[model samples]
Target chain A: MTPPETETETASGEGGETRTLYGSPEELPEPAREALGDLLLVLADTKRVLGIHYADWILGSPTLEAGIACSAMAQDEWGHGRILYAMLDDFGMDPERLEHERGPSEYRSSELLDEPTDSWPELLALNLLLDTALSVQIEAMRESRLEPLHHKVSKILDEERYHFEHARGWTARMASTDRGREATGEPFREAWRACLRWFGSEEDELASGLAAEGIVDAAPGELRRRWVMRVAPSVAEVEPHLVQETEDGWGSAVDPDWEGWEPRTRRLRDAPGPDDEAILSRVRGDRNRSLLGE
Target chain B: MSDRLVQIERSRPRGEGTMDWSGVAAATRGDRPDLDVPQWDEPAADLAEEARRALYEVPDPEYPISLVDLGLIYDVTADDASGRVEVTMTFTATACPCIDFIRWDVRERIREIPGVSEVSVETVWDPPWTADRITDRGRRLLNRAGVSV
Candidate 1:
């Protein structure tokens, strides 16, 4: 008799096709888990660093209203980072150490999140494009078989709605004004390409492996396509002078500042340390059964 | 030469009175107290003008927003003979993180003036700075940078 096909591949309605093969965290396949872990690290670290960057502007914003909005946004991103890190923590790693100890090079976040917001318009576009894309990604993860991740993803999706709305409102206002349109259009056009680079390669092995294991619901390309479609119409409405396409949106390059930047942090006095080994041991032991699905 | 020395002695300051010690103090100390006090012997000169002229020589490297413009050097009084200058300035913000560094930089540079013997920098936060207080030149720079002043 012919051997049963070990891998399953299928197309989800979101985009081209979601080919599910095998990278589920429950099964504890070494290579698959490693790739998924790296993907999670990138996502988690990006939010963490972006949170810090936004927090720096809390009192420095040009106006009081904007300052409060930015502060709220910073807290939201930090909260998301915490949740994602907790997932990584359950997977045999210390989230606190991973956050403060890693250099920029070790982070997997896209070049988009690294650039300091040089102007208000650039900041608005980035918050719109990047966070909106993240919202969709989190939505997809709602169905993940990794119960903890699925729960965390669902919670994050609810929190990101406000971020998405804020971006849309800011972009709408900027696009409506003559000077705003004149000033922001070119930068928006330029920044979108950097956003595109954030998504991994079309045939990224790590993404595909995660899909195979039913850990991640879709590939980055599918996510990219959905993001483009969702954002292009609104952006076109705002900047009628500009054309919208995958190339215009996704082929742009990253800013040099963000191009090679990474988080540079050290352990804070109150941060978790090696002394928590006993507590970690207990948690790890209790969760090991569900974690490894042994 | 002896005659000239006698004339110089005649021009010296005359003491008002020597410090008096009471009989009780002499009995407690077992000796009388003797005091010597120095006095300004020469006529006071117009040192203020000389100090003002000296201040002109101190380069205000930051232009359009000089020490005067930013109000950093509130008072530039000096004792030219002693060459001591006291400056009163306020920080941009009360919680300014750069306060220590700004004070050090100003003190170091101001001390380089030829006649300056001592420099004191005092930081005050009262009469806080506002955007309207920015000089015309500072306003122009902000406008050029696309910021509304």
Candidate 2:
């Protein structure tokens, strides 16, 4: 179904006449608002889960510097997640409830991040593949007509540069070693499939509707293609299905299993998310509950 | 640094009332005047230099050295036409708790400059910060404070 065109009002600024679709959540059409809310939840939950994954590796990483990097990445992901979660308030959801009280089944994170990574190489695969996929989606919203998103996109992307660098550096280093490549190859393939599936099919109504309304800049297929193009250089051997050399440029050949796809959470199955008890204990800071009000 | 240093131009017209800034496209190093090493003799240069110098007055909350010495201030430019001083800075860490206060301090301190009609402070994370960015002076200061670099 074709989404209704966003109602834009013209305003004069230093850059010239700018068109704004919605200044606040109340001004959005119900469908557009709902679509944006779901997208935001997906981003928030994914970041939250990625943060936990990174935190788990803080002590387990092979080197002290690597451990510190894990700690920093964990902090960055949590910060990004908190910022996105706070934006849900504009969409009429209680930020605290969505963050602290949500059960594992209610999480809207990607399936790749739903389970603890088994090895450092697997963590690197998640970092290089899944994290970059999420960033690509956020990048598509850089020029969103929605004001709130437009404001926050730059900061989120700015911080994410380090994440991309850390992942790329490690992936290249690991790819040079036989043992490293062997350990990471399967995880990379798994992450690649999950990321492709996370983008959903071209027929995703919410994604199409959001793209039509200028709330998001690209459709799921376009986003998946961009992500593959970005990641193919480092991981093409491990996941050859990502791209093919076309006359124009590199093109993606994604055949996601759309059957049983959960649209709201953007996963392939109704699996429970990361351990709820551990997530709550870390996210809620239960020990600091006494100091919360102070 | 390569020949492709991103020159971010932020301007706020006088009497706009709002403190909002609009950034121009990143220009090549050759296209823009070099603010990396302020002349300190020119009027605009003096203001920009004074702004950079004043940053030393704003210390990192945790460290004793100035934010300038700490390598927190990345770029500082003065727009003569708009009387706006724009500063691009970054935190030592992504999860810095002092970010808001440091930004506020930077804004307030730079506004103290005479003829400065507006001040804009932007925080960026590109080329993410590390201990190597710290200056020798900052290192000494940190060592003096019983903190190793």
Instruction: Give me the candidate number with maximum TM-score.
Output: 2
Per-residue alpha-carbon lDDT of candidate 1 for residues A184-240, written as tens digits (9 for 90 to 100): 776676656555545555556766666666677777667666666666665675555
lDDT per residue (tens digit) for residues B9-63 in model 2: 1111111333222121112111233222223455535667778887777767666
After TM-score superposition, the amount by which residue A140's alpha carbon in candidate 1 deviates from its true location, in angstroms, is 1.8
State the weakest 10-residue window (summed lDDT) of model 2 chain B. Answer: B21-30
In candidate 2, what are the lDDT values of residues A178-260, reduced to their tens digit? 78878887888788778877877798898888888778889988998888778877785545555676665566565777777
Query: Clashing pairs in model 1?
Result: A21-A212, A22-A212, A22-A213, A23-A212, A23-A213, A24-A213, A104-A262, A193-A252, B83-B117
Per model, the share of native interface contacts recovered reads 0.00, 0.10
Off by over 4 Å in 2: A1-18, A241-243, A252-254, A287-294, B1-58, B62-94, B99-149
TM-score of chain A of 1: 0.71
How far residue A283's Cα lies from its native spot in candidate 2, in Å, is 2.9
